[model samples]
Target: MTSDPDTLWRRCAHLGRVLLPLVDQEPGRKADRHENLRTWGIDTVVGERLMEIFAALAAHAVVIDSSVPTAQFDALPVRTVAEAATSKRDFELLAGLPDSFADVRDEQAVQLFRLSAYEGGQASRRLFQLSREVRHSLIVLAEHPLLPCPTCADVLRRATEANLPK
Candidate 1:
């Protein structure tokens, strides 16, 4: 028997709650953690979860737009306000994303992931410098007041702990 939309939605929400924290973990451990998530069949679950969140948000927008009378809608600008709020929420969610979860909205994470990969397996001076730069970017993004993405904040803390003088 096929699952109802509400059942599927709840599953997605549960998966997101579980996976998002893992995704917010240490950057250095991200590749390995992602591999484990994939092996445990959680990676696809998380991706599907994120998609469900987005779909629900879109449906809410549609419903709000439809509910408004056309003449009053134009005067109230409800649609525009809703779109702007959704856009900001989307950006905040993306700003919190981990390096392993690359999407169209996650360009910064992708760039940092590539930089870290390029510096791999070689204990050169440049590797340390590159790591520092990546960490700095993560911290700045995490602390950004406007968005203040909690995932970024978590990762930034992890990166700081990892890079501290030993």
Candidate 2:
């Protein structure tokens, strides 16, 4: 679809910021407690946000790309974390976490820290992959002629009119 590059960039500035900071830098402070907290925040929260953004990207792409019928788009499978999880459990016992530096050294605290860090890394990687996919889909859409079908055009039109992030 033909789009004004300037307008598109403006519309996507928020998501642009996200893609900007995702440069492949050295993972910082490998053992710092605060670093664990940061990773955890990114994994549990930023990860979820990225998934939403990715879905929006896919929706927009599917709406514009005529090669794939819109009917098939709904049936396309999207992988989620739950699908990757091994099992589900309801825990009756929840452990209280450490509050200070010294407490953080305890076995439970260390394990929790490691677990959070691991999960965060996984999420960050997933986010990176999703970003690449969304960007690629948008690029393909931009290079192609706008969908000529009225239904597809209307779907695309409503999406753009909503002023949702690209």
Candidate 3:
């Protein structure tokens, strides 16, 4: 059975939504936050992989909310605080960030690049492992697919079409 990239992407999106209740719970409130993955029967490595996939999806959401241009998805440039403070930087600021997030700034920059590509149709192992987990999620959805929200589907479709093979 041949699987296309779009199918995999849609599956990842669905799994992300399914895992949201688990991942979105406030870490402070959930005593067994760590164990939720285990209790839910997700293995350690698979759980970690799901987290990574969620991160990529969250990153894409951030990029879209910021109104990042589709053309810029391929070459997302990073900007420093100093650069951002100065009016010279043309990069868009990702909101809701803490002032003390400087340490993870570089990591955030790399994430921006990866998420942008994923949102734009390009998938990568370094950014988000496009492995069996992603495939399995899609297969599950394929068995019983749901209609995607129009806006979300449109964005994902545009991104996939823009990034996928011609």
RMSD of each: 18.5, 18.5, 16.5
27-93, model 3: which lDDT tens digit per residue?
4422343455455555555454444344334433333444554333323221111122222111232
For model 3, which pairs clash?
A: none
Name the weakest run of 10 consecutive residues (lDDT summed) in model 1: 70-79
- Clashing residue pairs found in predicted model 1: none
| Model 1: per-residue Cα lDDT over 66-162, one tens digit each | 4532223213222232233244333232232223422343333334333433555432232233323223333433453544443422433443445
What digit string (tens of lDDT, one per residue) describes model 2 on residues 69-149? 334433322221112111111110112212222222233323443344356656435444544433433333333344432
RMSD of 2: 18.5
Displacement of residue 166 (Cα, Å) in model 3 is: 31
Please count the clashing residue pairs in each candidate, in the order shown: 0, 0, 0
After best superposition, candidate 3 residue 35: deviation in angstroms? 1.3
Candidate 1 error regions (>4 Å): 1-123, 152-166
By lDDT, the better pick of 1 and 2 is 1
Q: TM-score for all predictions?
A: 0.20, 0.24, 0.24
